[model samples]
Target: MPGARSGGSGGDGSNSGSYSGDASGAVTVWEVVSLLGKLLGTVVALKVVLYLLRVCLAMAWKSGGASHSELIHNLRKNGIIKTDKVFEVMLATDRSHYAKCNPYMDSPQSIESLVFNSFS
Candidate 1:
């Protein structure tokens, strides 16, 4: 045949070049390893972010205030609370709006005396 190779000769009449047995530009082992490393790093970073978020939420819960009240409500959904009165009162009253600066902090806030005097 016109394009056929002779015995022990390259089909194109060239030296067949380096690694000529497989020359389809296949991915190298290093490239595969690098890709896996990048993927693993990304997964690890995502897990770290998720863990940080959980930590922040836990801190918020312990610190109390509006978020603490909401956490209590969520716990009640799972039957953690024996009654709904506490949740209902917390829902009816927004301590953050009623207080100043970090309204959610667990502490007694003073109300304006004028409002209190009105009740007198």
Candidate 2:
């Protein structure tokens, strides 16, 4: 036992590239899928809510002027303000009404509102 080697193991290996730990860090596939799903859900929810709001708004009327004040419209009608811009945007689709001022949309469209009561 005088010529015996000690602690010798097969050190043969087959790799020649630089190495580092996996960069996945903390996030998982499920996490990625869930985040994407949440984003999609948010987009869907926003579209649905906006659609419903537009539908509801279309079905209703504004008692008070929204963007333009009632007084401004009156001024326009009386040619004090001169509603050329309003006439332009409004008459873009309505063509024939280009020169005419919308008494309703100009002052504000008249609308009926449905208020839901949550009485138990």
Candidate 3:
């Protein structure tokens, strides 16, 4: 069949669909499947490692606080909110009113779940 490899000998006594690095000059179907499975596993493992690294880097900037003003103060101290105007604005805004959880933590928060769902 077209695009299919047969692991058998041809009419001229030559190996058909033979893979390299084997003295038998023939490759089994199970070997090909196993090799593909290993390749897929490696790719998935690498993706998981990359995702964990990204999460760690994002959480590195987080500075927990007790309240809105304290959170803004921490941000300024950490050189995130450089200008006084920005600091005042952030202080005036109550994160608890918008964020569903961890309002004082310096991290991205979703104000409304529906908004994100709409975008998706």
* Candidate rank order under TM-score: 3, 1, 2
Clashing pairs in 1: 65-104
User: What are the Cα lDDT values of the candidates?
Assistant: 0.64, 0.50, 0.80
Model 2 CA deviation exceeding 4 Å by range: 1-26, 60-120
Q: RMSD in angstroms, all models?
A: 9.9, 15.1, 13.1
**Candidate 1 Cα outliers beyond 4 Å, as residue runs:** 1-23, 61-120
lDDT of 3 at 57: 54
- Please give each candidate's TM-score: 0.36, 0.31, 0.44
Instruction: Report lDDT (Cα) of residue 41, candidate 1.
Output: 100
Provide the lDDT at 33 for model 3. Answer: 100
Top candidate by TM-score: 3
Residue range 1-120, candidate 2, lDDT tens digits? 888754443346433335433445567788799999999999999999999987665442333233335534444454444468874553344322221345335333322221122232
Candidate 3: the clashing residue pairs are: none
How do the residues 1-120 of candidate 1 rate in per-residue lDDT, one tens digit apiece?
A: 898667665867776455554457788888899999999999999999999987665543343435757645654554444476866776677666556566665445676864577689
Better of 2 and 3 by TM-score: 3
Q: What is the lDDT of residue 35 in candidate 1?
A: 100
Model 3 TM-score on a 0 to 1 scale: 0.44
